[model samples]
Target chain A: MTPYDIILTVLTTLLALYLISFALYIVRVLKGPTIPDRVLALDSLGYDLAAFMLILSIYLNSPMMAVCALSLALWIYALDIYVAKYLEAKEVGG
Target chain B: MSEMLPVIMAFVAALISIVATWLAVQERDMLIATLFSALQSTCYALIYYLLMAPDIVLVYLPVSVGILPLITIILIKKTERYEE
Candidate 1:
């Protein structure tokens, strides 16, 4: 009825959707037929998690937590780059 | 409902992380196992956030998800991909 209640409902629904996507990502990671499949799924999972954390921070009234979300977003690409380098170079280090 | 949402979210994230840990341990492919471990760490970060610990989440995200996985991938490349 109230505006706060509307916001709560929307956030809860979004969180549920996020959880569902997380489940799907895990399934892909677990049963993926190829290395790239798993890597792609993990990448998506990390991006989704970053968004989820941002929303969660808002819901929890802790703006500081957004920094974690930003850091997570930036760091996830390192995994992608590392995997790509390993797949290509056949040697991982610089 | 408002008061209990955090608890429920934390519980669900914990469950997901547990499953991820099991999958990681059971996986024979080192690369995939490392990815699973990263997923597990992601869930742990969520749980930490839900518990009102942003500080822990900040520390945990880089170490467990970023550095740990990078190190494991390097090790995998140094050795082999499959466990057998």
Candidate 2:
């Protein structure tokens, strides 16, 4: 096989593995019993998604997609912080 | 060979993240799960780097690894409730 073929196969395999992990993270987010647990799962899933986006950019040799990944990572952080603060306030008041 | 190194690193990081997610879900304690979630972020940062996106990694690593964890810990502290 050619070198390109070998590299392509490896990249595809790795991407597939990452996708499976992402699916598992989704299950955790759905099944989490507590709010904190769900938040944690969501946080993990966000990070994984960022990684996945980066990998896709590399696989496709597109630099523009990396910009999207950067923005998404930043957005998720804000969401996580906001949700955590809201949860804390609710817990304190109740 | 050198170009393929990034793919190899990405593969390793992805595997680490998968295992960490599994452990986070299996752990009963929310605090431990949060810690695992933070670990997953670190692995993801490495994966991002492997994908040749230093800019994205820079933004992601600190927020996911630092800010998110601190916020989660604070929420946990205020709640004082571990289980459902």
Candidate 3:
């Protein structure tokens, strides 16, 4: 096999493992007992997904996927901040 | 083969972050989980750089590494719900 093929194989294997972890994170998000727990899982999922997209770009030799990563990063930050603020308000109201 | 090492490193780092994320989920304390989340973000930033997206790395590193954790920590402190 060519060196590129070997590299691609290894990278794909790692990506598969990441996808499994991503699925596990989804389970945690669903089963989380608290809002923060769900948010945390969601945050991790976003980051992992961004990484996945970036890796896929490398594998596909496309630069456009990096923009997807950038967007994910921006959206996740906003979502996490909003969730934290909402949780704070809930706690204060109690 | 040598030229592809950076990609390999990036993949391994992503793997590490995934394992860390798994551990974070298993943690019973929210604060610790949040810390892991931050670490996961840092790893992702490295992966972004490795993928030749320095622009994305620059934009996200600060937001994920700086802002998100600060907000989460503040919320945790305010609510006093560090433990699950």
Candidate 4:
């Protein structure tokens, strides 16, 4: 097989790995005893998903999808900040 | 076999999204439910990406994951944390 096929195989394997971890993250989100725990799990989940998307874009030969991955990472970080503010001050500033 | 990888990945993402939606709907804590909903949206975005719809993914990502959760969280803060 060519290098392209090898890269495709690796990317596919990584996608599966990410999905399995996503299942674990969802479990943590659903079953965690405290709100912070769920938020942390969600944060990691989003970050890892962004990485997965980047790899997917490379595999698919679509550079535009990389932009989505960047936006996803930023939005997930914003989510963390929002949760932290709400948890600390009991308010999310308008 | 390799050509169908995207289809398989999309199916798995869709299944995960279903689980997330159910969890979000049934959870007692509004905040946790919102997080689950965000997870659901993330999965949907992945599904769109796998299906080669970059435009839909772009619009869906901001609206569902960012704005919708922010709105729901604000409502949760205004009203209550627990469902009851």
Which prediction has the highest lDDT against the true structure? 1
Which candidate do you rate higher for lDDT, 1 or 3?
A: 1
The true-structure Cα RMSD of candidate 4 reads: 2.4
Instruction: Kindly list the per-residue Cα lDDT of model 2 for residues B35-75, writing each as its tens digit.
Output: 67865776687677666666777677668866777777777
Over A12-70, each residue of candidate 4 has an lDDT whose tens digit, in order, gives: 78777877888898789778888899889989988988898898888788887788888
Instruction: Report per-candidate TM-score of chain A alone.
Output: 0.90, 0.87, 0.90, 0.87
User: Would you list the clashing residue pairs of candidate 2?
Assistant: none
Worst 10 residues of 1 chain A by lDDT: A85-94
The per-model lDDT (C-alpha) reads: 0.85, 0.71, 0.72, 0.84
Give fnat, all candidates.
Answer: 0.75, 0.00, 0.00, 0.50
DockQ values per model: 0.76, 0.05, 0.05, 0.67
- The stretch of ten residues in a row with the least summed lDDT in candidate 3 chain A is A78-87
TM-score of each: 0.90, 0.51, 0.52, 0.89
lDDT, candidate 1, A32-51, per-residue tens: 99989988998898898888
Residues B1-84, candidate 4, lDDT per residue (tens digit)? 667878887888798888888887888888888888988888899898888888888889889888988898788878878977
Whole-model lDDT, model 3: 0.72
Candidate order (TM-score): 1, 4, 3, 2
Off by over 4 Å in 4: A91-94
Better of 3 and 4 by DockQ: 4
lDDT for B22 (candidate 2): 92
Give the CAPRI class of candidate 3: incorrect
Give the TM-score comparing model 2 with the true structure, all chains together: 0.51
Off by more than 4 A, model 1:
A91-94
In the order shown, the candidates' Cα RMSDs to the true structure are 2.2, 10.5, 10.9, 2.4
Evaluate candidate 1 and give its CAPRI docking class based on DockQ.
medium
Worst 10 residues of 2 chain A by lDDT: A67-76
